[model samples]
Target: MPDSPKEEVDETGGPDLISFADMPDRLEAAGLTRISKQRCRQLAEEDPAWPVPLDKALKVGRMRLFDWRVLEPYFRNRTPRQGQRTDLKPPATEA
Candidate 1:
């Protein structure tokens, strides 16, 4: 099986794995839709809301506050992808 995340600590005391809670701010930050804490608490009750889907949305809007110190490294200075044709090419026609 694949190794556990860095945040996981085994009895052997190996390298600590990275966890969502310990992740950097940028990675933990929101993506597009922003949400409020009150809304997050509500979403937390729903499926696919609390962990990332909701958090990312709220983070993008810059609403929920977080400790970026550990989460910062996870994020990067990245720009949105260009709207280029990424579709797979169809098989070429025989001559």
Candidate 2:
């Protein structure tokens, strides 16, 4: 029987490995932030604080793959903390 397109064999020819193209959707499905390939690449280039490190990306020919298990924590940590606001001003006191 032929495997489904979504199911990719790993180097050891074990269970299915998630593909890079499907990463964003997987992240969303897992309740993590959804980031596109372009966005991931952009962050890698521009942001030193990017959650997923470039080294984590596995290059297979022209495709780039990632492990969701490894990335999930990073995404969760990236969320802004409660009560944290960039725009805030103190109220003026009556003179």
Candidate 3:
């Protein structure tokens, strides 16, 4: 067992540890698709499915560190949304 549950083993028996600051790179490394830090913050703020931090008391400045085990499933099963806004479609041209 790790000194902290935040570094605990995942369900798959692999080491699971991550920080909010490193989330984008870690997600990209796992082939889960990269996202911006701003997007990460958005998810943390707006996404209900976002995993809860294992160590809520711990903080790196204002950002919270999270367990990778908890996040892996969320990102892996995330529904892909269109990159462009649906309402932003250009006006149809007359033939």
Candidate 4:
């Protein structure tokens, strides 16, 4: 059996670096991250932050690309763990 275009691997014997278009599914499958291309675009429009700048996407031709190694941490951190509250609570009101 031969590898499909989408499954092509690199010299490192890992999946080839992919374009932003392919990120959502790949990230989910790899258990590395979960972000839609649309969400990624939205993030790209926002102000920069630390560690991984969600908006810092690179362009190759007309396609946007992101390094999985760099993005994995951001996604992992964003994902809400089981039975854990990921949202912030409002401050207590004063009487």
Q: Which candidate is the best by lDDT?
A: 3
What clash count does candidate 1 reach?
Answer: 16
Q: Model 1: residues >4 Å from true position, as ranges?
A: 1-29, 52-95
lDDT of 4 by residue, 1-95 (tens): 97766633455876345566777887789766567877666655552532345345565777766666666566666644344554776767999
Point out the higher-scoring one by lDDT: 2 or 3: 3
Per-residue lDDT, model 2, residue 72, is 61
The 10-residue segment with the lowest total lDDT in model 3: 51-60
Point out where model 4 deviates above 4 Å.
1-16, 50-57, 79-95
**TM-score of model 4 (CA atoms):** 0.51
Summarize candidate 1's per-residue lDDT along 1-95 as a digit string, tens digits: 99966542445765333333333322434353333444334433453413344344325243443333322322333232334565776767999
Give TM-scores for every candidate, taking all chains together and pairing residue i with residue i.
Answer: 0.21, 0.51, 0.63, 0.51
lDDT at position 78, candidate 3: 91
Runs in model 2 with CA error above 4 Å?
1-19, 80-95
* Top model number, TM-score: 3
Instruction: List the global CA lDDT of all models.
Output: 0.38, 0.64, 0.74, 0.61
lDDT of candidate model 4 versus the reference: 0.61
Better of 3 and 4 by TM-score: 3
lDDT of 3 by residue, 1-95 (tens): 55854534766876465666788998888888998877877787787777673345246676576767778889999996757876889888999
For model 2, residues 1-95, the per-residue Cα lDDT tens digits are 98857633466765344565676787788777778867655656666676556676667887666665555666677753345555686766999
Better of 2 and 4 by lDDT: 2
What's the CA error at residue 40 for candidate 4, in Å? 1.4
